[model samples]
Target: MEQNILDKANEWLTPTFDQDTQDRIKNMLAHAPKELEESFYKNLEFGTGGMRGIMGVGTNRINKYTLGKNTQGLSDYLKKSFPNETLKVVIAYDCRHNSDTLAKVVADVFSANGIHVYLFSEMRPTPELSFALKHLNCHAGIVLTASHNPPEYNGYKVYWQDGGQLVPPQDGEIIERIESLKYEDIQFQANENLIEYIDAAIDAAFAKSTIENCSFNTPTLAKENLKIVYTSLHGTSIKAIPGVLAQAGYTDVNIVKEQETPNGDFPTVKSPNPEEPEALTMALALADNIEADIVIGTDPDSDRLGVAVRDTHGKMILLNGNQTMVIMTAFLLEQWKRAGKIDGKQFIGSTIVSTPMMLELASAYDVECKVGLTGFKWIAKFIKDFPELKFIGGGEESFGFMVGDAVRDKDAVGACLLVCEIAAQAKASGSTLYQELINLYVDHGFYKEHLISLTKKGMDGLKEIDQMMINLRENPVSEIDGQRVVCIEDYKNSTAKNMFTGEITPISIPKSNVLIYYLEDGSKICARPSGTEPKIKFYFSVNAPLNRAEDFETVSQELDVKIKNIIAAMQLN
Candidate 1:
């Protein structure tokens, strides 16, 4: 172990820390030196969104001290930002182990600093915290969740008054303030008078907004006809989704009781993440047994959703984030056009790594499609920046979608409603969701996307991931599967270079550690590291013209093979 790591661990053994934390440090010092080093090697800083990590007794972990420090800094910053007002903030947590305790600790720190807190009485979806922040007219909000990460992991995400995660200057300023504070500086004493427990009323209001915003021209009979199988995957979505669906008149819904309970361990699945198909096995099986039209599963925090629909062969198939987003955005656009709302002043949002089909759809409707960096914070920022434009909806390729900007984040609750509306309307029109997707491809083009993540854990793993990016940057790939690399966009340096012409242009977006390559054949490959995890992700997207719906499977297979060939050629496997 390094001397600095040991020194940091020793500082946690002081009188400032609790006895249990001190005992754990002592045990690590006596018996688990490697674990100690891994736990204390570095402090868990806020990433593009917020702080997330494994839970334990170290600076690098999610615990009382680290979260306390964040809350203290945020409290000070909030006070400074709103000096003349009575500062108020709301806090919510998911069904993760230790989340409720950590949430109380955060509320205590904020209340100790003379800030009023509206803490949730029990576990709630993360998006509700965003909604409640603005609904309650609070200045900031915090939610204790690690999204789809394992039970051992937890996180703290800070939302501003706009209900979006901290972005740009605020993110950097809060990070600086957090770094300036020591563990001893965190105020843990609770001001009972300043802390209030909140529930029920907020849930009703959020469900109302979700229903109103996501519902379109779908008939009442259509909603009744759509049979759905839904699962919370042992997370917090159960607290809102079931009620929302019933209230929206979708009474033919089946809940996977095996996974409905809010267990932090996520006992029903290997991982609580909906993006993984295995996590939705129970719901899929239920859908099959019930002969349902659709299956929807939300992650622990209820921010990302995984969806499945019966294909042409009547086999249940999972749709990737891009597929879902394309379908949802197209549906929203068509509805808007029918309502005479798309007057060339409306726009939808997407990330750079998302499928290019979104742009095609936007062009078809004569609306703008703004692409931002990874993270929905940028999409939320779009609503703030371009107030003149009507913000329809937006999403990234991480199984996340935001509907109508009601909540300035990826909201699976509202997205779930939107998905059901699409499915319900399709069924009522004598079309299936899968057929609608194929029809969209016939109208636009067939686009397929694949994502692969390489996890590298521990301190050495971090260095290896960084070195991989470094190597890629130094020696860019000039070709992939015999296709010429026409352009390369380096977001880190904010530049896009044309390989053949040697022309360079500035990319007018916030700088991030991401790289993208565009091929002459219209293939795009993006390499980005996860902002919240120890994994690096590579996104591959390929598209082809679909003249008719009958050729959908053949063209889709071709694109899949093209993506696989690109992946193999790049040696990413």
Candidate 2:
């Protein structure tokens, strides 16, 4: 056993920690040195976003002590940032195990620091927390959720006053404050008078805002005629989605009863992530049995949603994040054009790693598509940065979307309503949602994207992922499947180099650890490490002209082959 690890373990046995925590530490020290080393090797990082880890008692785990330290630091920062004013913050949690208890601990720390706390009475969707804080005029907000991580994992995400995740200076500033504090410095005693439990009022307001923003003149008959099957995947969406649908006049919605209730274990699926096809198995089965028009499933926190619509052959086919994003952005653009709102003061937001079709679609509408770094927080920052331009909506190549600016995060509840509207209107016009997608490709270009994520587990895994990125940067690829690489965008260095001419141009975005290769044929490959998870992701996008709707499948297959060839040539397989 390392002396430093033992010393860290000994510090936890003191009276600063509770008896149960102390007992667990002693047991790990005596019987499970390896586990203890993993737990105490380092402090769980308050990364660019926030902290996430497997729940346990350690400096490197998601527990009362780790989260308490975060809250206390945030409390100190909030007071410093807003002096001479009453500071307020709202707190919400998802269905993950121990999330409720962890959230209360966070709230108590805030209240004990003389900050007023508005804690949710029960589990709520993550997006609602974003909305509640902004609606209640609070300075900050926190949500206890890991989004779609496995049963053992939980996380804490901080939101600023604009209802978006903390960005640039704020994230760095908060992390600094957190690192300067000790675990014993956290104030866990609750000030009951400063803490208030809230529900109903915020829920009603969020539902109403969702309906208003996403309804988009969707007729009552059209909504009634659409047959929809939805599953919460045993998470927090159940508390919000169904009611939002009813309020939006989507009464014919059917819930997958087996997965309707919130369960921390998420026993029905291997993982609770909507991005995985297996996560929506029960919902798809129900949709098939009922001959449904659409199937929707949201992750545990309800921040991201997966949609499966009946294809041209009446088969339930799942749409990837890029396809859904293009479909939704196109719909919103058309709506804006019809309403005469595209007066050149409107822009849509997307990430650099998303499909390039968004740029083309935005051009067709004579609006600018502001491309930023990954994450919806950048989109929210865009809205705040340019007050003159109206934000229609935006999404990334994840199972997340935001409709309007009502919620400054990827809002699954609002996105569900918007997607349902698109489906109902398509059905009313004698076209399925999938068919409408084909039409979109015909109008724009047929773009297909594929993502490959490689998970690396513990300490060594982080070093390996970092080395992989370093190798890609040092030894750049010049060709992909015989296609010449034209441009390379290294976001970390904020430089875009033209491979053919060797001319470099500056990238006007925040520095991030992302590298992108642009081929002469318009194929793009991006390598980025996941900020929230222990995974390195490779995103591949290819496009072809869709001159006719009848040739959609053939062109799509060609693009798929191109991506596969690129992957193989790069030895990524």
Candidate 3:
């Protein structure tokens, strides 16, 4: 065992820690040397978003001690940032195990530090937390949710006064404060007078704002006829989505009973992420049995949404995140145009890794589209930067969509309502949502996207991921699947190099460890390592013109073959 790790473990056995944590550490020290080393070798990093890891009794894990330290650091920063002001913050948690307990710890630390806290009375969706922060005019906010990770994982996410995750200087500053904290510096006691519990009033306001943001007016006869099915996947959406959907006038809706209740174990699914097919299994099954018009499922925090709609053959087909974004963007733009709300001052946002079809859609409506880094915090920053323009909606290819600017983060509740409204409009116009998707492809060019994620676990895995990025940059690929590589965009260095011209231009975005290769055939390949998880992700996008809707199947198959060829050429599969 490393001496440093043993020394760190020894400190936990002192009276500063609880008897239960001390006992667990003593047992691991006696018999589980490897586990002890893994737990104490290094501190769990508080990244730009915040900290996430396996829950356990160590500095390298998500536990009371780490959480308390983080809260104390945040409290100190808040005081420094807003000196002499009554510092206020809001807190929420999901269904993950220890989420409520961790939330209490966070609140206790803040209150103990003479900061005011507005904590949710029970579990709530993360987006609602964002809404509460902005509504109450708080200085900062915290939400405890691992967000679709395995059951053993838990996390903490920080938001600023803007109700978005920390960005640039703020993220770095908070991280610096957190790193300076010691276990002994964390205050674990609570001043009950400084803590207030928030409940129904906030929920009502959030639901009202969501309903008002819908482009379509109240439930029309068409919308009333739209049949829908939804599942929360044993997460926080169950507390909010159904109520919002009903308020939006969808009369016919079915809930997947098995996955409706909030459970940290996510009893009915292998993973709680709506992006994966397995997480939506029960919802899709319910949709098929009831022949519902569409199926919607949300992750643990209800910030992301996954959708399934019937294809041309009347078989249920899950739409990828890119496809969902395309459909939503198109529908939103069309609605805005119909309402004469688009006067060139409105815009939409997407990530660099998401499909370029969003840009085309925005252009069609004469609206500008802003591309940001992978996280929604960047999207929220765009909103802050361009206060003169209206932010209609934005999304990424990871099944996260935000319909309006009411909630700074990606919101599945509002997105769900908007999706149902689009479906109703489609059915009223003598078409299905799937057909509308094909129509969008025909209008804009057909764009297909695929994602490949490789997980590398533990300390060695971190080294390997770094080395993969280094190797790619050191010896870049010049060709892929018989196509010439025309451009290389290295986000880490904030440069876009034109291969043909050998000219490099600055990319106006925050530095992130990501690389993109543009092919001569108008295809784009992006490689990025997950900031919150132990994995690296590669995103591929290919496009072709669709002259007619009848050729949808043939064109889709051809695009699939092209993507497969590209993947094989890159040896990703």
- The candidate maximizing lDDT is 1
* TM-score of each prediction: 0.99, 0.98, 0.98
Clashing pairs in 3: none
lDDT of each: 0.93, 0.92, 0.91
- Residue 51, model 3, lDDT: 74
lDDT of 2 by residue, 141-212 (tens): 999998888899999999999999999889889989999998889999899899999999999999989888
- Predicted candidate 1 versus true structure: per-residue lDDT over 6-80, tens digit per residue: 899999999999999999999999999999999999999777568899999999999999999999999989988
Which regions of candidate 3 deviate over 4 angstroms? none
Error of 1 at 78 (Å): 0.9
Scored by TM-score, the top model is 1
* C-alpha RMSD between model 2 and the true structure: 1.2
Which pairs of residues clash in candidate 1, taking residues 3 or more apart in a chain or in different chains? none
RMSD in Å for all candidates? 0.8, 1.2, 1.3
In lDDT terms, how accurate is model 3?
0.91
